[model samples]
Target: MTVRTLFDRCRAFQARMPLAGFFSHSTAAVLHGLSLPKALEGDSRVHVSVVAPTRAPRGEGVVGHRVDARPSVVLVADLQVANPVAAWCQTTA
Candidate 1:
């Protein structure tokens, strides 16, 4: 999917989750202005993180994680996402 399509779809999905959702992993990396390897730039799923003790969201083109997200998630183009450090750490796991 196009970058715009991915971003738009993510934002739409985020709106439906509790308190919106925090983008994580590669998705957060992009929001934080980090460059991903060329091969991974076009991943289909939009990575998002939700609170622990909850099931990861499931659907087409979305990958979810359970984590202790910070209260200071940044907003990029109206998409809520984890901070750079948290995002980078998530990607490492």
Candidate 2:
């Protein structure tokens, strides 16, 4: 899918969630303008995470993570996204 379409999908997914989790992993990396491996450059899945006590989101085209600690978040393209350090660690994992 095109980048604009992917972003619209992510927005829709977040809208369905009760508490919108922050975008993480590859998704955050893209939002932050970080370089990604070629394998991940075209991935369309939205990576989202919520801190513990809040259940991880689940849906088509989404990879969800339940983190024990609250991650630092920043606004990117009007979406909540994990900070660079947290996103890097998540990508490695």
Candidate 3:
């Protein structure tokens, strides 16, 4: 999908979920400003991790992060973008 289109989709999906923060993994290398060090990037899923105490309400785009893994890091919803995985790919490549 186009970058703008995908970002819109992710933003809508994130709006529905009840999460504190969401982060990107391999797909978000560039979005997180790690474009030069892409050698460490891995995984296939557009993995978007969240830092919410309760399970985030499901919608689409993201698979939703579980609370069991994260022990800390919970910032408020002040994000500017979503579906950062795709954004990273666009930036890196």
What's the TM-score of every candidate structure? Answer: 0.77, 0.83, 0.41
User: Quick one: best TM-score, which candidate?
Assistant: 2
lDDT tens per residue, model 1, 10-80: 77887666564678888887767677766677776788778876667777777878776454588788788
Q: lDDT by residue for model 2 over 1-93, one digit each (tens)? A: 455776787688777654747888888887777777777778889888888878888878888888888788898777888999888777777
Give lDDT tens digits, candidate 3, residues 1-93: 333444455455555545454545443443344443445343333335555566654443355554444433322243333354444543455
- lDDT comparison, 1 vs 2, better candidate: 2
Q: After superposition on all CA atoms, how large is the RMSD of candidate 3?
A: 7.3
lDDT of each: 0.74, 0.80, 0.44
Which pairs clash in model 3? none
User: Which candidate comes out best when scored by lDDT?
Assistant: 2
Off by over 4 Å in 3: 26-47, 67-93
Measured on C-alpha atoms, candidate 2 has an lDDT of: 0.80
Lowest summed lDDT over 10 consecutive residues: which window, candidate 1?
Answer: 14-23
lDDT of 1 at 62: 78
